[model samples]
Target: MALLKEASNLKLITFAAIQERTENFSYGELDASNKPPPIQVKHLNNDRITGSAAQKFCLFRLFPIIFSDMVEHLKSFKIYLILREMLDIILALPQRKSWLPYLETLSINFQCMMLELLPDKATPKVHYATEYTKIIEENGPPLRYWCMRYEGAHLYFKKIAMQSYNFKNIPKTLAQRQQLRQCFLMSKCRFLKSYQEASGNKIIYMHEIDSKVKVLLNHRYGSQFIQSQTLLQCSQLIHNHVIYKQHAVYVYDLEHVEEIPVFFQIIHILKLNQEWIFVVDLLNTDGFSTKLWSYRVSSYDRLDIVSPNNIKYYHKGLDLYKVDHFHVVNLTSRLTKTN
Candidate 1:
């Protein structure tokens, strides 16, 4: 019984969703019986910063509020802008086609004229990057503004946890740890897939078609035929779309799957135009295979590894790509490009 109490005391479980709905529930669960000290869990809802109390305490973190209000309310507060690649933003939204239209309105009306339009007409263009940069510049160096890709949140959070809490809990059980790792990795992939489907990208990524074909080819003609088929299909897609001429192609592989050389060939063909193509493979059993693949393909120019359990710190960027367990490769240069 004493050993059971100690084990239960050491065991900690955290659920971010429940906390988001109501922190009271988290507190209630913690105070229920005092059998084991409850895990310290924080939901870190992105919306909380936009609420009224945040405006009083941490006004700079509020979203959808005016820059003037932010400047006026908090004279010297640290501001951070979490940005995602335009393609991933589209893929992550509920209505992908509506993204451009919504951005156009926000850029022209909210960000440009209403927010930054000075008495003179010398203001910079209202593109997303320009406006965001202007705000930071005018406001002074953000306490610590980081331009982060959504896929890289996992690594960022891991760093944050280690720095903040000195957490050194790396799972020991290979199979159990692998499952937990997959949960972390697949969470992002699943989010992006769902976002893409919801946003109306009938064809999520150009390579998805080829990837599907590769699966079929393996079953029908055996694995020996994969190389030729991958190359042929890649060439076909490149020729079909003018965009492929300018953009680089990336081929990602799972870490445990031993087909690095074949994927490298595919990456070579896709990056033939001197465009940036990234090939990522998760070598660890931590369930990052799907997410690493999605991170490789998602429109974000960079890849991040994040644990799903620590998703709150990365919600702004992470939540932007809520798709299913699938690969994503964003081909667009900006987050607001339409069609």
Candidate 2:
């Protein structure tokens, strides 16, 4: 199916009867007003098969042919990454109760790929394979979320300084751009009329959280939390509550010297030592590409939410950069927690 699709797109012609070759086989002779004639062939079998035979034929024969061609074109590096990440996700499959055999098979495939990619003894990346396996065994594959932001940090600096072309005053030009950009970002916090306008006024109350639920609010807003049976003094409320089962939120993220706002989903409400807290999962942005389908909070992972009031919005998307007011719920059903 993939071959047929690619062949159709690429306009590949298979000639069955043309055995003769001439010097005049140029665009003038072969081209018939850009419309190539189709080759006809006789079929061997016309009998239709159903049930298991049909399914086996479709699954083993049809899909394999499609994926085989697709896989053939992929670069070695790309193929390696795909295989590695696939094994990583499999290792991190939350419910690995009866999945030991499957995990072993995937691990074998990953090991085989590693050998193919790094056959020599002097390769540095070969060392990562050991670390990768160890990390997966310890932390259930960390999946793609483990290092996506750290990897993405490399690009942020590149994007910020890509336009610096001053040969004589390269340092001065970069410093000036960085300063101006940061100052402009900080200025947005003082006047959040733009942020408020972009992110609507729909709100969610803290009372919605069950009394037994754990909350983890940021230390910045620790003083605002007042003890009360029915109502709290802080009155935790989030915007656009009705649109999401989980609230889309912004919080301060430390990126180098500047603390910019990052978008995330509030997955759980928690409390420790009388401090109201929110357990948030990070969202993938243009700056960072992640394979996380949704944010799942497990007992193993702890994230302290920053005060929403202290969040400073970036000027790129007016209020929300990368995310719009459009509602998108995280894949919470697939979320799993380990004891």
Candidate 3:
């Protein structure tokens, strides 16, 4: 876990994702997708490659839940840097098509470094490293994707079978029922109207500000944050989200006992008496939720947003190493103009 938060590790992960082998190679005339080809690699390297970084990372730490929690503890400058590198490396491995040669080079270096750092331990080789390269050159899809789908289907079948008492012809019956159901579903009209559409709520009339910026109403949680009288005509209307400009609103940590400013991006906004109520996505900078480590999370069911007077202006720059398990954009160092 400690190594997971290291700055070096995160940086390595970054290099694996973006950096080319010589840092001078050009990938001209990319396809319509504008992305490189996919890469394939095996999960194991056999008994000889024991206790290797590649093995541990690819096999053990690849799980999203575990990796996300590990990313939260990276706070100190030294640790943050190491963690950034580690994340980059981990992310790069599965993206074999983008940087196969570079990944191979880095994996070799990682294996060597791990062996030297822990001299007494026998380092496991990257299982099927050469084989992975050959498979990728021959244009193979990632084995992990197919394996996961198969495993999921197997589990589903097992669970469904366990629930039924009739084991005599379960397999045959299940297959027939599934096929019939699938065919029935497939025969349905592709343009079938949903309940919402049939109910005439298909198009929601959104209030737009200045003909360009569409106004969003406050959710139940966001409405409770501000005083009732401070709100204007749209106070009672509840919405899922709102978008607002940074100048019109500021993010405050209502959940924290000490109540301080939290950096967040305002994705939506609502108009009040005179101020703007914001719908914000929390920034993953100071605190992150980890099961292993208790941290302050928003009391609101969704992310909490505030409209405070204290709008601290700071330079924003891109921090590519920042990871958001919730899939929200973290605050960048790049500066944006505000009133």
Quantify all predictions' global Cα lDDT against the true fold.
0.28, 0.37, 0.36
What TM-score fits each model? Answer: 0.19, 0.30, 0.35
lDDT of 2 by residue, 1-339 (tens): 222233334544222221111112222211223222221222102122222322322222222222332333433334333443444344343544444455455556655665664454224653454455445565664544555456456455566567554568766776787689789977867444422111222334456744333244423345443342232222233322211213334433434332222456555433334433445556543332122221222122335454334444321111111112222222211123333
TM-score of model number 3: 0.35
Q: Considering every candidate listed, which one attains the maximal lDDT?
A: 2
Better of 1 and 3 by TM-score: 3
List residue ranges in candidate 3 displaced over 4 A. Answer: 1-98, 113-125, 140-145, 189-339
TM-score of 2: 0.30
Candidate 3, residues 1-339, lDDT tens digits: the string is 223224235553332322232122222121111222211111111212233233233323222222443344444323233323333433322233544565456555544554454334332443333244445556544433335467555665676678766689998967876788678966864435321111111221333222222222334435542334232223121121221233222233333443323556454444445554555556543453232221232323234445533334332211112234332122211122232
In model 2, which runs have C-alpha deviations exceeding 4 angstroms? 1-109, 113-124, 136-151, 190-339
- lDDT digits (tens) for residues 165-242 of candidate 1: 533554333335457767998876754441211111122233654454345434644645444423321221222111
Candidate 3 accuracy as lDDT: 0.36
Per-prediction count of colliding residue pairs?
A: 25, 12, 41
> Regarding lDDT, does 1 or 2 come out ahead?
2
Q: 1 or 2, which is superior by TM-score?
A: 2
